[model samples]
Target chain A: VSLNLAFEEAPLRGSISFISQSGTLGNYLMLLARAKGYSFRAFVSSGNQAVLEATDFLEYFGQDEGTKAIILYLEGLQDASRFAKVVRNIVPQKPILIYKAGRFDVGVRAALSHTASIAGNDRIFDSFCQQVGLIRCYDPLHTFDMAVALTTQPLPKGKRVAIISGGGGYCVTMAEAACAWGLEVPTLDYATAQKIKEILHPFAPFPLNPVDAASDVRPMTYARVIDILMGLDYIDGVFMMIPFMFEFQLRSAAAIRELVDATEIICGLPAKYGKPILGNMIPRVSVGPALDLFQKAGIPFFATQDESARAMSGLVRYAQIISLAKEVPFSAEKPRFPRADQPIAYVSRVDPVNIPERD
Target chain B: VSLNLAFEEAPLRGSISFISQSGTLGNYLMLLARAKGYSFRAFVSSGNQAVLEATDFLEYFGQDEGTKAIILYLEGLQDASRFAKVVRNIVPQKPILIYKAGRFDVGVRAALSHTASIAGNDRIFDSFCQQVGLIRCYDPLHTFDMAVALTTQPLPKGKRVAIISGGGGYCVTMAEAACAWGLEVPTLDYATAQKIKEILHPFAPFPLNPVDAASDVRPMTYARVIDILMGLDYIDGVFMMIPFMFEFQLRSAAAIRELVDATEIICGLPAKYGKPILGNMIPRVSVGPALDLFQKAGIPFFATQDESARAMSGLVRYAQIISLAKEVPFSAEKPRFPRADQPIAYVSRVDPVNIPERD
Candidate 1:
C-alpha cells in the first residue's frame, strides 16, 4: 500500500509488517514482495515522520495481532531513548529485524542532512540491538530473505544441516557453504548410511552427510531419502540443491514435475517434523516454473547455496535469540530523556536553484 | 553470437573477452551483456574442455587485436603449471580476471564431478595468481563489472576518489562505501571547495569531498561540477550519484533528457582528463531511459553506491596489478607437473536408475 492510495484485489494478510524511512526503498520492497509471492500484514512508509515517528509505529505493532515479525529501514532517529524503550517492549512478543543505514561517519552526516534527524552513536545502537534481541541486517535483500525464512519456516532447533542433492558437485558446494555459514554438516550414522545404500544403485556414492543421489535417481527414491534424513533426530534442517541444467537436459518436463511434487512433500514435513527445509536451484530460465511451485508452496528458495545457507543460519540465530529472550525478562520503565518535537520540513522544488557555472 | 549461430544486426565489438566453463553461465552472461548494452569482442564456453582448455583460449585472446581484458570462469585445470604460464604471459599485455570456483573441499569435489578434472591446491593457485599479477574475482557479475571498468576506463593513478551527488544521502553512502573498499575520499582543497560552492546554492551544504548539489540543480550545473571534480589533479576518479527520483518528480521528460545529456558530457570528461568516472542512479522504473542513456554512452552504471565503489576498486586493483607485473619477469621454463589427458564423460540419463524406496 502506498501513501496516496491502496490498490488491492483482497485484504493483505501475513505475519510480517515492513516500515521504511525511504519511500523508494519501500516501493522497491513492495515490488520485490509481489514478484516473490511474499505477503505482508501491513507496510508503512514513514516519510519524514511529520506526524508520528518510528517509535509510535513500533508501539502500535507491539499490540498488533497480525504482525509476528517487524522489518524496519531506519535512516535516523529523533529520540534514541524512546526508540530503545519501544524496541525493548515489543521484541519479546515479535522479532524485530532492522536495516539501519548510516553506519559510518559519512553515512551519519548524510542521514542528518537528508532527514534533519541525528543518527546516534552506531556502536551504542549495535549494543542496544544486541541487548534487545534485534536482528540487524546489512542489506535490504538479506533483510527480506531472513524475514521470509523467519515468518514461513519453523525456527531451526539447532545448527546441524543435512545437505541433499541430485548431483555430487552441488552437494559438495552446499556442504562447504553450510559450514562457512556456521551450520554443521555432520556425517550420517552407519545405520543410516547402510539404509540409504540399500535404496541406491551400486554406482551411486555412499550416503554421507551431503547425500548425493547420483543425478538420475527416481523422484520417489529422492523423496524417500529426504524424508529419512529429516526424520533423523540428529538432523536439524535440510538444504536441498537441485541441478536444473543437468535435470533439464535429462527430462525437463518429468524431472521438474517430480521435483515440484517432492518439494511439496518436503515442505509439509517441515511443520510436522519441526525442522526447516530450504531449497536452492541452480539458476536457469528453464527452472522458472519449478521455482514458482516452491514459492507457491511457501518454501524459501535461493539462487545460490551460500545464500540458502546464510538464510538458514539466520533462522538458527533468531531461534536462539527467542529462546534467550525467554530466559531474560526486560524491565518496564519509561526513558528519562526529554522528547523534542522538531518541525518537519519538506524539501520544496518549485523554485529551481540556479548556480552560475564556473569557467 | 551463440554456439549455434550468430543473430546479429552488426558485428559485436568491445575490448573484453569472456570464457566460461558452463554454457548456462555463458548464456546468462550474454543476456546480461545484451540487457546492459555491453558489447563483447568474444565469448567462448569451454564445454568439458575435451580437446582445448581455458588456457588455450586465454593464449589466443592475449594476442587478439580486439581484446584488452580477459574474464575466465574456471572449474578446474588439467595442467596447473601450463595454465599459470599462460596467465603470466598474457597478464603483462592484458588484464586476466579469473573467477576460480571450488576453493573449499566440497567445492573442489563438486568441480571434479561437474567436469572430471581435479581441482588442485587452492592456496597454491592463490599464490600463483598473486605472483602472476592476475586479478581474482569471487563471482561472475563481479568479473563482468571489473572487466568493463578495466577495459572502458583508464587505470586510476591513486586510490583518492571524489564523490559528487545531487542528493546528500547518496554521496554520504558512497563516501562510506568508497572508504570501506579502500578508496580514500580526501576532503576537497579550499580552492576546489570554493569553486563547488559557487556552482551550488547558498542553502546547500558546504562543498566537501562528497559534494552534494541541492536536488534541484540544473543538469548542466551537475555536469559542470563533475567535470571540475574530474579535472582536479588530486582526484584519481569520480563517483557521481544521480538523484533520478527527485529529478523524475520535478520534470521527468526534460529532466531525463538533460540528465542524459549531462551524463554524456560527464562520460566524455573521463577520457579527456584521464580519470575514471562511475555513476550510480537511484534504481526506479521511471529512470529506465536515463539508465539506458548511460549504458548507450558506455558508462558503467550500478544499482548501489557500494557496487559502484567495488567496481572502481576492482579497476584500481587491476591497474596496480598491471604495473606490478611489469616489474617482475615470469620464468621462461615450465614447471615439472605432468600433463594428464582425461576423456570427458557426459552425464548419461537414458537408463533411469531405480532405487528401492524405504518406508
Candidate 2:
C-alpha cells in the first residue's frame, strides 16, 4: 500500500530523487522540501521492504535517465555487502547522500523494533560510506540543505570562494565559517581590487577578499563587482551575504526592492558563467516580502552564513569527487536480491477510530 | 534618539536582560525574541558609546534586583579590565551570557567601524570569558535560545536526561545528540521500565532510557511516564521529544489539540515537582497552532534535538557553576573607570528623507 500527499499543486521537476524507508519521514521531507522551494524528479517510500529493499531502489535510480543525484534515509541494512557493492557501482555515476538514523545503543534497539532490521556497527558503516563515496548528513534539515544546493547550483571547480557583504560583521563571520568549512577565501589581486574600488564610495575601505561593500546599498555597485569577480579565472564561486533587515533599516521598501533586483542579477551570473553563486539573507518579518522575491526567483537564500558556507563547501567537495571518479576505472556488477512484482502496497484504508479531539 | 517598536502588546515579564552594542542588532534581536516567545525585563542599546560603555550597563544590571540573567552582544571593549571585574562579580550571582562578534580579522575590522571600538585579541577575550564563568554563545539565535531556557525552566542539577519520543529514529538521534552535548542518557532501571511497559502496547518494545513511544499516541501514557520519571530522585531533567507533526497526521485537528493540552499538563509538572522539562516539536505549518499553545503556556519547545540538548546542557553547566560559586569565597572589588554625567545621547530629530515605498 502507498500513502501519498502533495503539498503543492505544481512541484518543480528536477534530477534529484529521494528514497525514504519510513513513510512518516518521507512526508516530513516532502513538507520541508516544499517549504524551502526544493524540487525533485521522483520519491520512493520503501516501507517494510516486504519484497524490495533500500538497495533495490538505489540501483534502480542509479540507471534512471532522469535522476542525477540519489538521497537515502536508511534505518538499517538487511544486506550490508550487497548494499556496499551497489553503492560502489553507483558512486562513480551519480552522487549518493545518506542519513543513517540508528547510531547509539538505545537507537539500535528502537530501530530493530521499528523496522525489524538490525543496525550494524555505526563506525564500520561510516568507514564503508566514506570508502564508497557517500555524503553522510547528520540532520534531516542539513541533508535537504545540501541536496537543494547540489541540484540547483553549478558545482564549484575549486574551494576558492569570494565573499561580498554589505555589512562588515557578516563578512567577518562568513570568512571564519568559510575557513572552518574548508573553503579558502583568497585575497583579491591588486588589479581586481583596484577595479572594485572605482565602483565603491570614496569613504568605503579598499576592497579585500571578503569585499565588505559596507554602506554601499546601490544595486549596480554590487552587480558590477560580482560580475567582475565571477569573470576572474581563480574565483570558483561567490557567497553574497545580503543583510536584508539592515538594508530595510537604512533604506525604504523601494530601495530594498532594488536590492532584491540586484540579488537576482548576481544569482543569474552562476548560470551564465558556470560558477555557483549562493545568497545569505537573515530571516526577518519586515523583509518577508523581499525574501519572498528571492525565493520566487529560485535563488538559494541561506538563513545563516555557516549554512551557506557549508552548502558551498559541499558543492566543492562533490565536484572534487566527480573529478577523481573520472580517473578511476569501474566495472558494473549488479548484486542479486529478492524482487517482487510490486514494490509498494497502497493501502487506501485509513484508521477509522479517532481519538477525542480537544477544544 | 531610540527607535522603539513593540511587536507584541502583552509581553511576558521576566528576569532576563539584554545589552546590545548596535541598535540595529537590538531591533533584530527583539523581533526574534518576540517570534520565539522570549521575554525580557529590559534591553539597552549602548550606541556609539558616546558616554556609557557596555560595562556600565553590565554594572547596572549586576546590581538590579529584578535581573536574574544577563545577555550581552559585544562588538568591542573600551575597558577590558573593568569589564572583567564586573563580569566576575556578576557571574557568582547570575548567569552572564555573551555573544562577542568580530572574532576573526575581518570581523575585528568590521567591529571597529560599526561601533568605533577596538576589537581586542580574541584569544585573550576567550580566556577572560572562561575565567569569569561566562557562557559564550556563537550566534544571536543561540544566545536567545539559551536565555529562554534559563528564564523558563528550573536549573538541571545533573547531566542525566531521559529522552522520550514517538519515533524510533528521533529517539536514536536525540540520544546521540544528548550524549554529544554532555548530557548523559542513562538506561532505565528495571522497575521504571516495568512501569512504562504496563502503559505501552504489547507490540511495542520494552521501555528504555530513550523511550521509543512508537505507535502510541495516547497523551496520558506520555504524561504518566513523564510524571513518574521526573519524580525519580536519580533523574535530573527530561528532554521530551514530541513530534506533534506526526500526531497531526495520524489524528484529526481536534485530536492534535488534545495532544497539545496533554503537553500543557506535562509542562505544568516541571514547576510543581521542581524538575526541568524541555519540549521539542519540529517547526511545521500544520502544527503551528499546537506549537502556539505550548508557547502561550511559557514552555520552551526547541526545533531540533541538538538545540534542545544544547540548551539543557547549558542549564546543567550553569547550575554547576552556581553551585561551585557558593562554596568559594568571593571578594567584592570595583574597578576604576571614567565617569560622565550624561551617559546617553537621545537624538530627537528623525531623518526627513524617506525612500519611496515599493508597490
Each model's C-alpha lDDT? 0.66, 0.68
For model 2, what is the alpha-carbon lDDT of residue B260? 69
Q: Candidate 2 residues B17-44, lDDT tens each? A: 8888876556556655665556778777
Judged by whole-model lDDT over C-alpha atoms, candidate 2 comes out at 0.68
Candidate 2 residue pairs in clash (backbone atoms < 3 Å): A1-A345, A1-A346, A1-A347, A2-A345, A2-A346, B1-B347
For model 2, residues A62-99, the per-residue Cα lDDT tens digits are: 98877877889888888887888888778767778887
* lDDT measured at residue A149 in model 1 versus the true structure, 0 to 100: 79
Which ranges of candidate 2 are over 4 A from the true structure? A1-15, A29-34, A37-43, A243-264, A284-298, A331-359, B1-16, B22-50, B63-68, B102-118, B243-264, B284-293, B331-359
Q: For model 1, what TM-score is found for chain B?
A: 0.81
lDDT of 2 at A112: 70
* Candidate 1 C-alpha lDDT tens digits along A42-105: 7776757998877887787778887778888788878877888788777767778887766666
